[model samples]
Target: MRIPFALAALTLLLGACTVSTGAEPEPTQVAGAVCDVPDDLRPARPYRIPQDEVAADVAVAFNMLAVSWSPQACRSGKDYPDARYQCAANQFGLTLHGLWPNGADNKHPRYCAAPGPAIAVETVRRHFCMIPSPSLQQHEWAAHGTCGWDSPEAYFAQAAKMWDGLNKPDLEAIPTQRLTAGAIRDAFVAANPGFPRDGVFIATTDGWFREARLCYSRDYRPMRCPRGLGAPDRERLKLAPKGVQQDAQRGVQTTG
Candidate 1:
């Protein structure tokens, strides 16, 4: 028997609306990364316990891969002693900020153990390309690393693995007028085919793009980001352009 005309139309509409459930995108190496680390690079300062910081060994609900836009960090002149190294030649872009284990409702675990020994100077030098700051690397190990991994080496290895896996977009290519939080997220998803759109979060300061936080499950698969994490989609974003120095005295914004 022939199907009813209305039913046939409905079936066609449903077929057209069906969503594809394809395999997830494989992670690729980031392009245009400029490490250019110096041979003599050393920790700007010795590691010390973060004053007024306390340990919160709460249950980890998920993981976040925080990546920084190096130009923005350098332009702000905030990371100070760390800036001496990271901003020296300004060759970094989309550097690994840290891999943090976040708990539910923002009660993330940190500084899980007392300061043992400073991370070996050689170890700090090895990962300088990825982190750029020796003191920050040591701090990350003592604070976030202690809560998850047993040794600094293991923690950094895991972080490096994840950092190398991401296919980061080249921010300098995008026109400044079209650069927005949503545009950055779109670029990320486009670069990583099976990556979820909501998995990327943008962090900004004074309307400048600072960081991109990618949400991940315990197994390290990309997942939807929690609400209220970073800047909204429509917010206009500015980039501090690699090699172009910002006039902090005048608070002028520069584009690549």
Candidate 2:
């Protein structure tokens, strides 16, 4: 007999529900579900998805495709089968405004209601956190396309971990002063040795630093970067409060 599709889907959602396993943090607990995940969003389990691979998820479960711009506001792609989207749809290609997507000129009658946009927001949010297109389609499609987890708890836990990992990297309190790019990189590789070699991490770093430069007019990427990836770029590597790189580099060794 075929296993129920829901059971199969559930299997995909869980890391190893059937296997004998040690108790672990729920996705909500580990991911910081409560604050980051809205009430209407799904909760996540403390699943260990890779960092670089998290952002590309389409998160269309909000059924945004079910809604489109006015016919005039949309354009066809160069060819068929790839499909067309709203004139403002950033998915078509590199957009002038980046992914700061423009609003659709119209909304579907079904989605004009409150839950509609909420769902859409949730769908889009997954893309922000690195939920790539395929994973979103496979795991999030039937769930109404929200970019969040199964429960608020899971969402919050995941959020918490992400926030801590990104926003504050003392390298397990090893102190940032003595942390050279090489040392920090070593520490980072030690902690996450299994991470795949991919450009997404670089992309995410670029995104983070770009945002930092835009927001603070200063290099704030290290504040949120993991130690390994935190090695300062030659041009902007200095994390010194006094804007003195060599001095700060020396201080780390003195303290440690």
Candidate 3:
């Protein structure tokens, strides 16, 4: 299903938005020097999946660019209205869904051990408007973050860098009239020079566009989507109305 950042100090450190519909996502704002990605970090490389494996094996994902539902949609009048998630959704639009790590086969590693929480609740408060929630932060770290980094701080710092580097399309500008998924994917390809056309995937419910995903290689470079992700480019697609309320558990799956 749908899935799942930062460090503070030797003794203490860890913390972390909100998502708005039809609005541009806010830039991540993190305080302290630790928030930056290390200059020496090595990037993951990409390779084409073998044809034989493509059919029998599960889709492989190195990293992904995902958008999440607004806090009001996820928490408003719900059994558990997470104040932190709501706070974040209110401040940001299309917040990061997750950065997942997967293999070519069915095996996917998740919820790995972490030395401690990725970010403290207070640190989470500092970037509440931009980050999704504390639970998401921890889940992402324990599941996907551990595969890419040794500590939550390093993983979060890199995530910030990835978000910063993305040349995402403007979802706010999606045309309301009849459109094809190809047109939607093209919008993204136009914005991101190196991004592959087949790499963009869509997720929706009853013709309402819920989220768009962008796949990346291990080294953080764009690559062709293996299969079974978004709609075919030529297929007709629909976008949800502006400010559309999403299901409470939006982004429950972590894969790209």
For each candidate, give its TM-score against the true structure. Answer: 0.78, 0.23, 0.62
- lDDT, candidate 1, equals 0.71
Better of 1 and 3 by TM-score: 1
Clashes of each: 0, 41, 31
| Best-first order by lDDT | 1, 3, 2
Model 3 per-residue lDDT tens digits across residues 1-256: 3222123232132222222233444333332111222212121111222233222223445666664433333433221223333442333345565676666555654544443533554434433443445555655665566666787667776777676565546555766564667777787789778788777777654554555677788787887756556676667765533233434453242322
Q: Considering lDDT, which of the candidate structures 1 and 2 is the better prediction for this target?
A: 1
44-121 per-residue lDDT for model 2 (tens digits): 222223333333334221111110111111131111111111121212111111111112222211111112212243
Off by over 4 Å in 1: 1-33, 44-46, 50-52, 79-81, 244-256
Which residue segments of model 2 deviate by more than 4 Å? Answer: 1-27, 31-35, 39-119, 125-172, 194-256
Of the candidates numbered 2 and 3, which has the greater TM-score value? 3
Reference-based lDDT, residue 55, model 3:
25
TM-score of 1: 0.78
Off by over 4 Å in 3: 1-61, 69-91, 126-129, 242-256
**lDDT (10s digit) by residue, model 1, range 4-100:** 9999856543321111124532222223644544555554343555545654658888888888887777787643226556776546777887898
Error of 1 at 82 (Å): 2.4
lDDT of residue 71 for candidate 3 = 30
